[model samples]
Structures are given as C-alpha cells and as structure tokens.
Target: MTPRTGGRKLCGADELVFYDITASFEERTIFTDILKKTAERVFIPLTVGGGINTLDDFARVLACGADITEDSADKRSLAGIFLSYQAPVEVPGVPLYSYLRTITQKRPELKMTARKFRARVGEIAEQLDMDSSFITRELNVGFSGGEKKKIEMLQLLLLQPKLAILDETDSGLDVDALSVVSRGIEAYRASCDGALLIITHNTRILERLSVDHTHVMVRGRLVAEGPGSLIDDIDAHGFEQFEVAAQAAGA
Candidate 1:
C-alpha cells in the first residue's frame, strides 16, 4: 500500500494510481469501468495504467471519468484525465524523510494518539520479537520484503477501510514472516468492519486469514470464485487444472 499524504486522512479522496503493467486491454477496460463507478460514488480521483498504447484508449478511459497519466511513449489527450510518470515507483531525488513526513501528515487519521500508536507498535514489535525502535525505523525505511508486508498489514489495521485489496502481498515472505503477516490480517478482520480481496498464489497465508471469498484469475478473467476451501484445492492440485477448465469452457 502506498503511504497516504497524512496519517489521518482516509483513502480514495486523492488520485488512486494503479500499475497494471501486464493487464490485457479488456481487463484494463473493465478496471477503468470499475474506477469510473467507484469515482462516481466516492467522488475521488482515479489514475490507471499498464499496457496502455493509443490515444483512443486514453479517450475511452477519460470518458469513463478518470484523470490519465501515461508513462508510455504513446501520446494521447483525454478530457477527464491527464497522463504523466514515465516509470513505476520512480522517486527522483525525493528526500525520504520529507516523503515520510508528508505521508504521516496527509493521512492523519492513520496517526492514532501517540500513546495508541506507540502501544500498538510496541505490541507488534514484541509479537515479532523485534526492537521497538527497529519497528519504527522499519515502518519508514530499510525494511525487508516481509517487514514491508507486515507494516502494510499494520497500516490496514490502522485505516480499517470498508474494503481492502491485497495484490499478491504474500509473494516473497518466509514462513515466519508469513505467519506474522497473516496474524495482522486476521487481527484486522476481527477488529474492523471491512472485507478483504487478497490476490495471492500462495495458500499457506490463508491458513490464518479467514477468506470470505476466493477468486481464480486466468488470462485476466475471473475463471472461478468459491469458498476458502478453493485455496486448499488449488494448493494440492495447482492452477493447471483451473487453466484446463478455463480452456475447456472457452472451447
């Protein structure tokens, strides 16, 4: 999750940037439609990308109510959106401390009472058996992949959105880290009134996080949706079976 401008502000008010570098055109269209609907209801800015290449594509996206920013060489002009950013996650000489300060302030809601923040941070650090200072610093920078995921889960705990989306957030965690991450996710579910959409290929992480729904994607389409048990089946048999099933249906 990208850190918000301040700790207290809720998400969705600012432009939401999606890095969909490998999504298909149809998938992009569907995503744009979703963004449009979401923006209409929520009244927030939406920015989308990944595999975009034509002026008409930009026009279509903008017509749907998005502010476009394109990093690709393809030049396009759309009324609702403006395109920029040539590379993903590029910070050109942006001061890390300044950036962190901005995020901390912009999402002020995320900043709990200093006592609460410190207590929760301490508890999480203790649970992970790390130093409190280490956790604080890690939350800002120099975090490993697992640590970043854990911090992100912590952020979710703090923010408690109506819906949370985890896009392959478990890809590189070790067993212990995965365990910690799962516990944080579970804690969020137990404490918050929110639903989670976790996009992960690994089933082990699901052991702790009770998934209300599971979805399988193939060729940028939702090929299957089922209970958490689907994760078990996928773990045992792998997605090859699902791919075959999808192919058979297409045939």
Candidate 2:
C-alpha cells in the first residue's frame, strides 16, 4: 500500500495504516517537492539502506530512503539456502569430508583427469599449508579451527563457486596461520569472477584484503556498514553505536 512519487490517487484500502520513517527531519523536509510528495503518500517507514560504505554515503542514502539488513543464526535459513552444492546440508548428519571418497564416484565429471585433479587440489592445499597427505583423510578430523577453515577454502578453490558465504572464516587462527588463510582466500578471489562474503568479528585477516563493504549486524539486524576502514573502527570501538542504532530502529 506504499507508493513513492508519481501517484495520482489512493484507492480506499484496508484498515490500520501506518509506516516507519527512518530519516532526519531536515532531509525529510529540506527538499520541497519530495516533502510535498511524501505528505501526499501513505508510507511512514522509510526503507533506509542499513548497509553503507561511508558515513556520508549513509547520510546520502538515508536522505533518499533505506532501512533494512542481515547476518547469522542466519546460518541455516540464510547460508543453508544459498548453498545448494556440496554443502553439509546435502547429507545431514554426515561429516562433510566423509563424503569426499564417494563424492567423485557420484559425479563422473569430478573423476575425469583424476591425476590432474589430485595435483590441482594439492597445489591449493599447499597454498593453505595443509599437508598433501591429509587429502585422503576425513575432513575436520583432528583439524584445528583454522585448519578446518583452510580446508573450506580448498573446497572453494576446487569448486570455484560463483558466490561464497564464509561464516566466521577466521574464528580460530593465530597471526601466522591467518595469513595462510588470507592467501588462500585471495587466490580464490583472483582465480574467479565470483563474489565472497566472509563473516567474522576479527579484523586482522582483513588488513591486506580488498573489501568492497563491511556490514555490522546487531541483534540480527544490520545497523551500520561501510568500507574496509569500518573493520578497523569496529576492531577498535566495537559495535556499540550499531547496537544503539538497531535498538532505535526497532523502537
């Protein structure tokens, strides 16, 4: 029932009409034509883009209209849905790596040029500093958190997915190990025209990364977002401001 600009009339609609508006009074009223037009509309909840690359950009977009965002607990509903191939969701209750032995058997395409395939996988594995011997072993078998993450990156290199959503990829890694993980990630970024989404609270791994945007989600809602600089700021100041913003938005 919300119509923004260029509407001649409003037909008699349903009951309980109300909308949320997220904007400063100045921006809402400064533009004479837009303000007049808004006064004529039925929406109050401004859809301000909670994701931003800079504070000025945030202000700019808010001036326009935006108010929505996302992240985890989202693992199942969000990540699970987007991931259709070779994900843990494919075989419930089975360790992801356990399927590796039989996976190639399931798909003939993976078996073609098997020798080249193993070598290719070895190169990527070494990029992660993962031992070549571990290839035949089960996944996540006595692997450290960082090791597991690296293996995940190995899968990414092998599959070359068009889009990858890595939740908490840097959860457990020391400074040195993180560099290996980052390198693997960078390699995958370089090898394909795919998109990568790395979700984590840590900032060290991002130091040498070329991040397009970083979004901060508080209580499952995105409160702020910006460029790579945002990561450093968050590492230093944390998400206090974003938490407050999310709360205010909900209220």
Candidate 3:
C-alpha cells in the first residue's frame, strides 16, 4: 500500500477523503478498478468528483460504493455556468461563429434568431477591437494570446452565464490585451449582474473589477479571507506571508 493509503487507515470513520480520476476517464477499466479498491478499503464517507459525464457514470460510481459523486462537466451547461480555462482548448474543425451559434441556440430562453445572433456577436467582437472576419475562422485555431482571450470574453458576453468562473484569464496577456480583458470582465459584471468566481495569481486583472471577497489559499488550504481590501494587501506584500503561515501550521 502507498504511504497515503497507510495514512488514511489511521482516520476515523467520520473522516472524508476525495479522489479525482479526471485523467482516468479514457480508461474506464482502470477507473472502475480504482473505485472498487477505494470503496472496499475506506470506511469513511467518500465524495468522488471529476470525469463523470453521464447517468452510467453516476450509476457505476455509486454501485462501486462511492457515497457521493459530482461532475462539473455534467452540470455546467444546464446550469448556465461558464468556465474559462487557464489554457482554452482549440477546436480545429469548428468555426467560431458556428460554435457560438450552436451554443446560443441551445438556450431557448435567449430567443435570438440566427441572423440576430450573428449581428450581436459581431457587435461584441467590434467592441473588443477585433476584426470583423475574426469569427469566420476556426475556433481558437492559430490564434494569439490576445485573440484567444478575446474569443473567451466573447463567449462570456454571448452566453451571459449565471456564474462566470475565470481561471487565470490574465495569464500570458500583454499590457494592451490585459486592459481589453479587464474591460470585458467589467462589462460582463455590469451588464449581466452575474456572479464571478475569478481564480488568478495576478492582482492586476482584479483592479478594474469590484471584488466582494478575497481568499488566500496555500497548498490547497484556505489560510486567509477578507473583503476587497485584501487584494491591495496581497498586491503590496505578495503571498510570502500567507505561504509562511501555511507552512507554520503544517498545511
């Protein structure tokens, strides 16, 4: 048994453990074997998440004795949740306009015709200072850092999700691109009045936006939390203090 497994054996039945098998999704045989092993050995309540995409997945996990199962991918679309990945995936064969249209039409409440949707997207693209022909190209294929972020922002505006989870949206962006993205985020919050869950190492992106809460996490543990002023503190002092505190507490 692994050292981690040995450690888990010392825990009481009330203790909770989490396992992520997102990478094992493609190899179901291995994934199921792991579930069976974890289920048979662990005595505590288990919350298994990741890589579960369907009803079959849910059934398989529960049948294997996993107490609870959750998958963000399963609920993201139906719940009107948008997540901007740190590195957005590229769709080589799909045109941007076509992809946007497909997702927009899927939401019946939007009640936008194809023509109107096209116009709306164009308007947003223009606002981002993008070329009119930009959306005609394949989605995220052969795009620069700025172009990719612009497309992500376009999706954010077009879909107008109830919650926008932006993961390091400012990564690799130059000053100009960063400025544009900050404006897009500002516009989204102002117009959509949507809840935002932004995860970023850089405080520059948060400058233009209104931050309600700031949380400092180190080594997967939340060490500090406060209001918007926390951002300014972090900007000036950096994360060294929080990291030191986390280390001191054996986080």
Q: Per-candidate TM vs. native?
A: 0.56, 0.58, 0.72
lDDT of 3 by residue, 1-251 (tens): 22236425664456445456656456553276677787777756566656666645655665566655243563445445688977788899999988988888766666597789888998888878888788889999999988899999998988887778999999999999998899889889888957889999899998888899999898788899999999999998999999999898894
- Order of models, best lDDT first: 3, 1, 2
lDDT string for model 2 (1-251, tens) is 45535433345433222133244666651333443354456444333223333334433433343322222333222221123222222224445444553443333334546577667777887778887766655556666666666666777776665467777667657787788878977997899776778877777778878999888887776677778778878878877878877778889
Per-residue C-alpha lDDT of model 1 across residues 189-219, encoded as one tens digit per residue: 7887656777777788788766677889999
Prediction-by-prediction clash tally: 25, 11, 0
For candidate 1, report its TM-score: 0.56
Assess candidate 2 and give its lDDT.
Answer: 0.58
After superposition on all CA atoms, what RMSD does each candidate show versus the true structure? Answer: 13.8, 13.5, 9.5
The numbered model that scores best in TM-score is 3
TM-score-best of 1 and 2: 2
Against the hidden true structure, what lDDT does model 3 obtain? 0.78
lDDT values, one for every candidate: 0.59, 0.58, 0.78
